[model samples]
Target: MMGLPFFRTPEIETPAEIEAASLRSDRFRLQRQVDWQRLDSIVTALENGRPRRISDEDLLDLPVLYRKTASGLAVARETSLDAATLAYLEALVQRAWFQVYGPRMGFTGWLRRFVGGGWSAAVRAIWLDICIALAVMAAGTLVGWLLVSREPDWFYALVPGGMAGGRTPGAGAAALRESLGTKPGSDGLSIFAASLFSNNTGVAIMAFALGFAFGVPTLLLLLYNMALLGAMLWVFADAGLGWEFAAWLSVHGTTELGAIMLAGAAGLHVGRTMAFPGDRSILAAMQAAGVRAAQVMAGCTIMLIVAGVLEGYVRQLVGDAAARAAIGTGMLLFWLGYFILSRPPRERET
Candidate 1:
């Protein structure tokens, strides 16, 4: 058949004989499993100017084979050839390559499934917690602000102990502004990690702490915290310190405030369960509420860490007003899109 020892036998046939043999083989086939798309791809490769044309010498690099059930013509063992198969063999190799790897990883199909599943799942929990808690907190804070403005001293006393550096409201506001607008703080990462842990723990404690009030105290505490945020923000804005407040607060504010509200909501849930005790016993209701609240707060803690990072590092590092605005807006959009636009895995029918 050939000079090469590997060319075990010669396959001599006229074009008419080859066609007739192909027809006979096709008649008894279990299925027409021809990989024609791969042939098309092989053609495309040639059209694109492959470095070298396939030649008889190229057959040495490829494994030559014959199938009894298929046509008795020689075929390449390798699915993809290295610019060296004869035109006919090149066609065969391309078809095999396409059949093996081509159908599985379609880019368009992959992207659709990815957006439907992975990305959506990653952010959905955080989004749900944010939406539900934020709306409630906003309302509570507004009411608290109205209540506290009439009695300023009482409101001041409600703030928890251990503020950073004992800075006055004015001084703290300035520092916060500086912190937000300046480059990354020296201990920004540490601050973020510490604040997130502490803040989340604070919410958990708040939920536990308010238990003493038979739940009213917890509601009051949350309302008080919200009022303080609203009033302080009002003060900052009135002093023409809007950007600084937004920058300083939003950096960690998103996570911290979000966590706080979740905690407060947890407390409120406990209180409501006890207050109503609809069909279930008071103890059972409280237990159920606690478990759900724990889930929500746990998610909130994660949000705090992310918020703290942005607040402590990214927010501070980006000094330009426009940059701060853009980042803040992006975060807000992310929160909104994740929660509102993205559907949960549970909602999707399997």
Candidate 2:
């Protein structure tokens, strides 16, 4: 007992020690109080949408004040400042940092940029991939038509049972024609649209996602999808409803198929970069290609959504073949013009 004399634990802070800490914190705050307050005010004005209230001089001073406050926080952290001072500085530094270096634009601004030129720019950046994908798709369609023409059995292999939905190879003209028309009830149109959207989205995603496998899978996917289209076309053509089916499909197919091509191109772009990295490492090339491809894929998703709407509602409501063709043609032109004519801000300036 004598050997183990009572000793004060370092964990216990005495009242006088607490008071000294408080004084040190107060003195530290006083030294940097003005800069901290200035940063807080600027941040407050920005957060409250009162940027106009801030003066030009204060705006110019913002970064400097932010750096000073951040430095103060570091010092406080290192010196074991009072908890209250540390907490205040932490909050103030976080708010200041956001105002100083956070995102320059909101979602709406980003969307406007994307729609105006970002999407089109991304699409243009992968023009080579788009060309290759288009060729592959056309070849695939030809192959499907040739296979089904030679042997009706190939239709079952290309088109799924649910998709065929009574529009099989040997189906009568009346049945095939009826299949092209809208159903009697309108209640299920929403569900139908959603289902189509989900299905098309899945195909688009697969096409885009499979590019990581050196793009072979993506090419195959695109070919398979176009072959399905070819199979369907053959079915309708065999019954003399080819033009009718073409019109029906065009109402949505222009957009949907375009989206698929873009997705395929995105995948191919990734694959091509990986295969031929040039001076850069394969990983670096893939990263660069991925950014552009992702942008194109995003646009493809929007296109797929539009296609779903047109397929579900417009295709159903519009029975006239000419009108449907006109709509589809107009959409195709719109996309072409948008991608071709729409220039980025930098390009426009130049």
Candidate 3:
């Protein structure tokens, strides 16, 4: 009563049909019945948009089970069975077929999608938060710059000497100027730049990882990190090589600091979701915001690598203040243009 009735014959079964049906039914029920049932449930739920209820193990087994169901379906077609059994196998095969060979985005495809538009869309969505983060960093920089400029001793208090790499406020001008150029006999350029890059990466990681706690820690982190930058610059400038130091720093600062700022923005995004999760539950809002934040953070990480390489190779080769400024400024403008001005509009109308 349950299959292609137009092709079906009378209900009476021959002895051969009965024997074959018995063997096939027994084989399918024992070997594949449970998997088919599970597959049916998964396919049903997926079609309904409630896949979250599916367990990870079941999700993992979906394709495998789907393939197995297909094999069983092939077997079913070769064997005699009741109309009801044939109909059930046919339905299961169709569902499994959709899943096994359905449209899907593979890894390379996904990477292309992310690069093409995902990164830009994420950046645009959190532009306001990025502005706020930059403002905070600027405020902290100004405060630290002013503090060190007023009382040179504040540099020592604000920035660790180890991080200063002997570029203290009181260090001799000759000694300080030496830092403007690559060290005379140093193979430490790449190592040093990589170390600094790692340090910056750590700060960004901490800023993002700690953002779920209402973003207070993230705020403090941004303030402190930017303060260090300002204090370092002030110290170098006090030695009468402000422009030189600016040039040297700019070779990497635009990308490095920009990366940190984006991390701060990601942190703030999480914190805001925690504080004001509009209509959705806090967990739901956080989940959505986290995806956007991750996209921004990924781009930030790439920027940091670019910055580190420049610091190691490009900055090392160039020591003139003007040349350094030109390179650094050009890099900064490139980033601003790429992130803010270069991307195409989201959608086009024919």
Candidate 4:
């Protein structure tokens, strides 16, 4: 009765006939049409003790894809389906649904995917952001050095508020002491998560908002973020905190800085289009760039969440200087290897 082309051939009267139909049924389901009766029959075969076998048709079906029935069947046939497999399948369905029917990968994955595919993509985005940040940092460092060298008294004027007077070498120690004073309660996770979310949202908002003021505003914002970082580091250096501050920052700064840079890059991209609309209309260019920029910003948001989680839980756990240093260095390296060195697919074809 089903409209499926496969069904039109004729119904198999007995279970034996259907068992023989397994391979062809797959073809019918996948290349042809939805055959609910055939699907039911396949399920019945499984329930009755036949080894699971799915057709290419099953693979093509959205419901089957969502359920990961093919994967499940393969796993089940090869070996017993474990709890982990079941859990993974469930997660696949949920994620697939979210990706397809929902709002896409959001601010996080979208931004990350701008650079590459999957986690690797996020890593690439971070790398690009870092390179840009470093360029700014190096330029700032040169300027700071020249300024400090030329006019020692004017160092304080160059640095921003709150940090201008804070003793850096002592800030981490002081912050640590203050952090120690607080009870190691459940609130750490919440605080970290909140910070992560807020920081990411801040980046996204800055990236989008600065575009309205022409490109210069976005570039200034990036420079401003870098200045804050440089100032913070300068304080640490002046205070003789040495590697202690580095280690402390390693816990959260890596991810935070990465996100900020990403936001900056996104902002820069928007501003660039505005400043030099080349061939295309400015609005058209902005829209095109906006879509891509949004993807990168979304990725940055996810990075913020991940960094926040690490800072909240892992940072609290690692009180030792060595472990913190290792983690910080490791994170930096991991990011470097993943982004700068990644051999992505040729963009020309993709």
Candidate 5:
């Protein structure tokens, strides 16, 4: 019983059967070979940066050819076509697909676009947040000035001892003036620049990162930092070094403070969007706002780097008060012009 199986074991394909399969595979390839070759040529031209070599008719035909070739790939996969034909079709379809729908520009082109107009547009988009943050910073500065003016103890409370660097409220005009002077050598300039850059970048990042809490933290952070500035301004102005102090501060402060303001504004933009999503859901609004805020923050980072260089090197090298003021004014003007005038033509139309 066990010896008598109901069905015979299936035999392997004969030589004739193997030949037949090969002929079928050949026929399949021959049917689609023309379309595949055309797609490959078009893709190769694009990849080689020879768009001019491709005819207008071929450009128009690209999507169609890609679709047809893609369909052939599907059929080959479903029917278990020969391995070589399968590989060729898969590769051809991929190339044709890229030609039909892919990023039109490279990284350099993207960077150019961003520097040329994209960043400024994003900043302009968040103008409301900027106005609010500016007002808060101003108020903070005034508060700091008043608090220290009313009680000298507030100066010690507002400014850290290391930052004070012996330029306290009681410090004489001579000591404060010397504090503003450039150090004798370049020994610590690099370290000073790196430290300033690190500190400023940290503040900027915190202002942005804390925006998720409805932007209150961002406002407070800006307020506290500006208050420190106001306290120091009082200390210097008290010592009759107000003009010199302003010049010293402005050489880097213009760019550095502007970056901080932008960072705060970016955070406010996100928080405000999430707090009041208007017609959109909170998630969607935050997503949209996050994109623009990110652009502004990216620009802020660049500004901070520039500020660090000015603070560390240029401020040290240039000692004249008027020269420092001029440099600061020039930087402010450049940023103003960049943000207001750098929109792309298309953006201007909209």
Candidate 6:
């Protein structure tokens, strides 16, 4: 009996005391109702399709009002307010909370920002890397073309088996010429484009994935890729189809090779960041580098997709070599304008 604890009954409020508590809650709400109404009006206007009517000052004050409303709600809960008043405050705070802390823009907004400037800005930031990638690819192509042209037999080593799907060294001049001609219909082009995309995507992804290996693999892959181009050029040149082949390749090469170069640049950016890291730790450098590289890589993927369509579909439908060259030149110029001239908004984007 000494060890056992006694339990006490809960305090029951008198009817008068309950009425007094409700009165106090009413008074509390009346004191705060003006500010709550102001917040409610703004929130309602925003929610009911009049967002533009809300002034900048109102927008700035919104969060402050939200906090005040929330505080009032807490007080209402603790003070035993009437059910109607508590529900009103609860709804006010709940709806206003979205305006205070919500996704300001959606997917379409993001797409607009990215297409307008974010991507080009990302590419421009890594101009040095792009230049280096371009230089390396150019050198590799030169080396491949020179070696194959001089030795002739070096074409086998420069281009792996079945890599040259169309104009290989073994192809006769007549066959090489025929490869550049347009088919009768647009039907085959889509399939060819799909195949081209699949093949190039593999190379692009491999180039990007290898960036973690300190960039040597990326460099080598780019070198090998350009070597194949150079070898192909030589094969066509040997067949007296150099102009036709250049036109054919250039039709898609403007965007296709450009995408590959951008991808290589992104990879090199990652590799260089990992290798050097400057004053920062490798992990910190990589974190920043990854974001920058990813931004560029996103644009690269898009370019590759466009290139695939041009190569597979448009080129197949267009018969004239002159027109193909013009199209190629136009695309190259378009990219130049897109990345270099299209300035980003001066205001910070979310």
lDDT of 1 at 184: 40
Q: Between 3 and 5, whose TM-score is larger?
A: 5
**lDDT tens per residue, model 2, 1-350:** 11222222234269898788778878998999988888898999999999999999999999999888888887887666777787797888788877888897899988889989999999999999999999999998988988999999999998777666667788888866766667676332234334445666787899899998989999998888778778878988999988987887788888988998999999999998999999999888989899999999889979987897887678778878899999999999999999999977663462
Clashes of 5: 0
lDDT of each candidate versus the true structure: 0.51, 0.83, 0.79, 0.55, 0.84, 0.81
Query: Ranking by TM-score, best first?
Result: 2, 5, 6, 3, 4, 1
Across residues 89-185, which tens digit of lDDT does each residue of candidate 4 receive? 3444344454335663467664455556554553344354446555764665456545554554445665533434333333555543343222466
- Top candidate when judged by TM-score against the true structure: 2
Candidate 3 off by > 4 Å: 1-22, 25-103, 187-195, 342-350
Pairs with steric clashes in candidate 2 = none
Model 1 segments beyond 4 Å from truth? 1-136, 139-180, 183-201, 208-214, 341-350
Between which residue pairs do clashes occur in model 1? none
Tens digits of per-residue lDDT for model 5, 72-143: 777776665677887787778777766677787898987788889999999999999999999999999999
Q: Look at candidate 2 and tell me the lDDT of residue 244.
A: 85
On residues 1-350, what C-alpha lDDT tens digit does candidate 3 reach at each position?
12332344345459997777678678767787898899999998877768799999999999898878776666665655556666787888787667667666567977777777677778888888788889989998988899888998888888765567777778888877766667657542344345567778898999888888888898888888778778978877878878887787888988888889889889889898899999999999989999999998988888888887888788888867788889888988987777765463455584
Report backbone clashes per prediction: 0, 0, 0, 10, 0, 0
User: What are the models' TM-scores?
Assistant: 0.48, 0.90, 0.71, 0.52, 0.85, 0.75
Tens-digit lDDT track of model 6 for 90-119: 788888987778777778987788889999
Kindly report which residue stretches of model 5 are placed more than 4 angstroms away from their true locations once superposed: 1-21, 186-196, 347-350
